[model samples]
Structure formats: C-alpha cells, structure tokens
Target: MTANTSKSTEGAHEPGGFGALRRLHLSYAGEVQGVGFRWASKLTAERVGCTGWVRNEPDGTVTQELQGTPDQIATYFGAFSRVFAAHPIEYVIAEKSDISPIEDERLFTVRF
Candidate 1:
C-alpha cells in the first residue's frame, strides 16, 4: 500500500501563537520493524529539526510522535521517502493524527 500523504489542518490553533507548530502521532505498517525504520526516523527528525520519538510497537507496526513546524515535518517525511527509496523500504502510514505538542521538546529519539 502507498503511504498516506494527506496533510491535516486540524488542531492548528494553539493558545500561545504557536499555530504553526504541529505534532502528529503516526503509525506505520508493512515492513516497518527490524528494518532500521526507527533509526531512520530519528535521523530524519534530527536532520529536519523535529522533536519526536519513534518506537516499534508490539502489533507489528511502528509508532511515532513528531513535533515541529508543519514545514519541518513535511521536510522530514520527504527525506524519509528519499531514504526509503534508496534502501527500498516499503511502508504505509496506517494512521496519522494531530496531537498536542510537548513543551520544550529538544530532541528526537528511538524508544525501546
């Protein structure tokens, strides 16, 4: 299945004029485990100046929360697509939704 590329404009309002900052919870499926997906996510997040955590879920999917400006998040996904293309990693974004951004988040990490 192809990855979801739809962008959600929901939850664009933040109390403190941080409307451009978006946080998304995403679940990826299809060959997402044991294929360096988490590592690539961490690297991509850092490269794009996004703060989030990625982890392998028990249900054979990868879950991630990414926080950044919408542009940064889009850049992160673009980079991931490039990397995955080069490495031939296949995945579908099974789920995606906007969530509250963490205050003072500074890094992206791989969660165990």
Candidate 2:
C-alpha cells in the first residue's frame, strides 16, 4: 500500500480497526543517544496517528516499536525521517520488523 508521504499539519488520529497493520522496529545507529530522539519520535508519532513507544536502548542505539495502519505508519516513518534529519545525527537505520497484524492502539508514547 502507498503510504502518506506528507508532513503532518493535522493532529494524528487512528484510522480505526486492525487492517493492514504495520509493526516497525526502528533502530538508529551512531550518535543517536542524548539527542532527544525519543521525544521527537513521540511527538511526531502523535502527529501521524501512530500507536506505540519510542525509547533509548541500553546499547546506545535508539529503538522504537510502532503499531498502526500501514498508511499511518508510513506517515510516522516520514515524520521520523524529517525529525531525524532536522536534528544533526550520525546515521539512522530504520528496520521494518517481520511482525504482522499489529495491535490497534490510539496513542504513541515515550518509553522510560
């Protein structure tokens, strides 16, 4: 499915139901810590109607698990890339997970 590639100007809201869910496990390598990555993700996720959590990994890499419709997920990804690029960073490796049928949730949060 084609994902929304636009930057969010509206408040993100779930599209409802569990249809074509995309669960993504994103990993940012190189200088990802102590740069407010999690906060940016949480904010952007809300703008994209995403449900999940973003947090810092113990291994220095930033990690986040996102669950939502494929389109909304796409927008979330776009927002992440925009936010990541907006701030100076080393490198980002956003890896999509093999998980399927993501749970339907209405909020995105920052994991402590």
**Strongest candidate by lDDT:** 1
How high is the CA lDDT of each candidate model? 0.84, 0.67
What lDDT does candidate 2 reach at residue 10? 38
Please, what are the lDDT tens digits per residue for candidate 2 over residues 1-112? 1222233323333445345566666666677678777888888888877788888878887777787776787687677677755555765464534344345577888887
Tens-digit lDDT track for model 1 on 1-112? 3888565657654634434678998999999998889998999999989998999989999999999986788799888888777569678998888887887889999999
Candidate 1 RMSD computed on C-alpha atoms after optimal superposition onto the true structure: 2.8
In order of appearance, the predictions have TM-scores of: 0.87, 0.70
Worst 10 residues of 1 by lDDT: 11-20
Q: Distance (Å) between predicted and true CA of 32, model 2?
A: 1.4
> Which candidate should be chosen as best, given TM-score against the real structure?
1
Model 2 scores a C-alpha lDDT of: 0.67
